[model samples]
Target: MREPVRLEISVAGHAGHVFASREGDGGSVPASGPAVVLIHGIGVSHRYLRRLHRLLAGSVDTYSIDLPGFGATPRPANTLSIAAHARYILSAMEQLGVPEFVLVGHSMGTQFATEAALQAPPGRISNLVLMGPVVDPKRGTVAQQALALGRDCLLHESPSSNALVFTDYLRCGPVWYLKNLRLMMEYPMEQKITGVRAPVLVVRGANDPVADADWSRRLAGLAGRGQLQQVQGTGHVVQHNRALEVRDGILAFAGLGAAAGGEPLPGNPT
Candidate 1:
């Protein structure tokens, strides 16, 4: 039987009364396994990482949160830059009293994870796993790219779109979205990629049209200690369609053994 989803409330910086949810072996990082926190793409929430959580739950503690405005959380008034989102996640980690852990981010959340790792003093973040990272905005025109980033980061599109992922910034409304888009456009992700001290694993779907395999390789090449992993027969949501593979890759990256059902990453190491 499928487990019922559980919701929880927590306070976040500037954004009061933020919402976060979990569906795993309660919040306990294994003594040997590293803690893993899953951050979703621009339009989804912890739900995006649910399948991945289930695969790894048996070996390591996993937590997934709705960014400020997206899930059950209300939008915040603070400037919602990539840095701010990282800080919010960090604040949540502080509340949980987790001193160090691995960060697994999808799509836009990859930028937030990278920013978080850069901000923290060396070694605070053990490793970073980025799935379908958006290093370059492929929306044709510059303005189109800006608009897409803004919409993805701020505006609530349809109910079908996961509002929780972009909720906090949405709470700030259109102006906030525009500001965030401008910031996202200006932030030099490639410039900062090499400075990340933690080892990183960039995974992408073999068929991911948005973040194609070539882009994934480039992303892996940017980190100080980085490598690429591919999920076969999957798209951008690697966790959902290829949960077992994703789980095993993360485990191998963390020095944990192979997850029960799949082989670990099998490419030439970077």
Candidate 2:
């Protein structure tokens, strides 16, 4: 596997980080095959998405980004809106010379992805993969989301997953987490998804209490070209425990097939 190159970039005065890896020889991927960009959820960094990035990097260039204020990146001077976060991502992509790519987002990352898609030029994004998207309108309040997340973690998450998540939360700190959590809750995901030009795939863990099956399906249906998939026996952080499944789903949606060879990526279930 290719080792990812870490990057520190400035976008509109805010700094962000990216871990970039590529398929095969590190040559530029053709326009026909768009590179993949991964956006992680709030209060967490690229650590949760590292497995998925490694898997996808075998067939396509992959970028896992740490939006400003999360991960190792410092918080901006002021709280940024969802649109501002999207702009920051777009700026980073521009700096990387990625004219077009697939945007894959998880949880609150989905909101950022959607906003980015809306802001990008018509054909910049080929596909949008939203895994365990958040803030279901019916249960849009912070209390409801907290209750759902707590329930899911207690019932479905593994010990390692909990450890990683909470540790990242500690690094992110309560103030930052709550600030962004409010932004996540206030954003209207269902309505914003309708504006996305790319085909949409909404993925969920079967036991993800935060983004339940019904909400996932609804979010997908709202998009112009949307679909949904559920990974069995996982919770909200599906990409961590079920990385292979999530990777295959993304490849299939992006029309990349199983992998370079016509076989499932190693470590993936046959």
Candidate 3:
């Protein structure tokens, strides 16, 4: 696989980093398809999404962004709202000359994706994918979310997944994570989903305590064009471990059947 090109971009006075990679003999994606952009959850960075980025890169152009305050990007003077983060992403994409593409977000990133879809110009975003979307209003409190996260890490997540997440959390530091966690919990995801114009694919790990089945299904149903798929034996960080399955689901949802191939859906183990 070819190494992703690192880019430093500034949007609205906030600097961010993006790692872009393409498939094919010379790292070129076919012009026929829209590019795929991946956004990671809160307190983490593109590292968690890298597995999925690589998997999808074989068939489409892929870019994973490190939003300001996470990863190597420096935190801005003010805490940004979900909508602000979306604007930063849109601005960065605009600067990069990405006129149209598929936008995929996981956990808190889903909130950012939803806002971006609403704000993007007509036809600028072809599809939106939300993986393990956040703040199931039923468990919307910070304490509840923390408990769910702990439960997910203890019972559902793999050791490697735990390492990646906790390490990123350390990098993010407690103060930043808590600030963003509050923002994530306050966002009205269900209400916002109804406003998105693009088709939406809501995906989750079968055992993801963070984004349970009922919430995921309800989220998908809220969209004008929406569908849900579950990856078995995975947790909140599904894309990191079950990347192939997630990639196939994304391709199939985007109507790229040849790229998706005939991979059978993973069954939920009893």
Candidate 4:
């Protein structure tokens, strides 16, 4: 597949970039359907999501964004809150002229994505996907999260995924990452999910140590219209390792085809 076209987006006074592509669209076609906007966690950039982005683009328009202060985007003068990030994200999507789209966020990106869904106008954000969401309240702290992530990286993640993460972290640098670490750890993801009006899909990897099964299920239950789907044999970066499965679940969530099999949540709609 060809590399996605980078679109430099100016949102207010802030600048960010998004890699836009779709099957045969050649970066020229206007997004026609509910597009998929992939948002990465802190430190990492759109590179990790490229494979999954292409896979999803085969059936729907896809845009993987590099948030301000991450990826190629320059660091902001000050650390922005999740709400601020969400606002910029919405503005960028509007600038792109995406009529309606799904918000897919990994790790702490879930915090930003959930905030965006809450801030967006009804119908503008068609759906929300939280993949390996983070800062589980039970273990919400720098040390706790770091230990879990370290264990996950050392024991479970594939070699390629770890390499991608290491390079991205290097690009992010420790100072910029630490600056925002406290905010991510403090964000109440569970409470935020309850405010999202759009359908929420909480996806977790069966082997993920960070967003464990219990936390994922609770997050699903918290949403007004939430569902949980765990991709087997994959870890935190499930989208990269099991792109097809994640695509199926997302497409199904977006009402494009048959329902994807997911872990049952007693209160959440299938």
Query: Number of the top candidate by lDDT?
Result: 4
Kindly report which residue pairs in candidate 2 clash with one another.
none
Candidate 3 regions exceeding 4 Å error are 23-32, 258-270
Give the winner by TM-score.
4
How would you encode candidate 4's per-residue C-alpha lDDT over 1-270 as one tens digit per residue?
A: 677899888776777898988657677665577889999998999988988998887777889999888998978898888899999899988887887999999998998999999999999999999999987988887888888899889888899999998999999999999988878988988777877889889999999999999999999998888889999998999988898899999999888664588764544333
Better of 1 and 3 by TM-score: 3
Error in Å for residue 189 of model 4: 0.9
TM for every model, in the order presented, reads 0.75, 0.92, 0.92, 0.96
Candidate 3 lDDT, tens digit per residue, 1-270? Answer: 887877898888898898888656443333446888999899999988888988888888889999998998999988998989999889988777778889999999999999999999988999999999988989978888899889999999888889999999999999998899889988999888888888888889999998998888888878878888889898899999799999999988887653443222222221
Candidates 1 and 2 compared: the better one by TM-score is 2
Candidate 2 lDDT, 85-191, residue by residue in tens = 89988888888878889999999999999999999998898899999998899997888999999998899998878888899999999988988888898898977
lDDT of the structure predicted as candidate 1: 0.65
- For candidate 2, the per-residue lDDT at 77 reads 73
- Give residue 175's error in model 2 in angstroms: 0.9
Q: Which ten residues in a row have the lowest lDDT in candidate 2?
A: 261-270
Candidate 3 local distance difference test against the native:
0.86
Q: Any runs in candidate 4 off by more than 4 Å, and if so which?
A: 264-270
For residue 10, model 4's alpha carbon misses the true position, in angstroms, by: 1.4
Model 1 alpha-carbon drift over 4 Å, by segment:
1-12, 15-25, 28-33, 137-183, 259-270
Q: Which pairs of residues have clashing backbones in candidate 1?
A: 68-168, 69-167, 69-168, 70-163, 70-164, 70-165, 70-167, 71-164
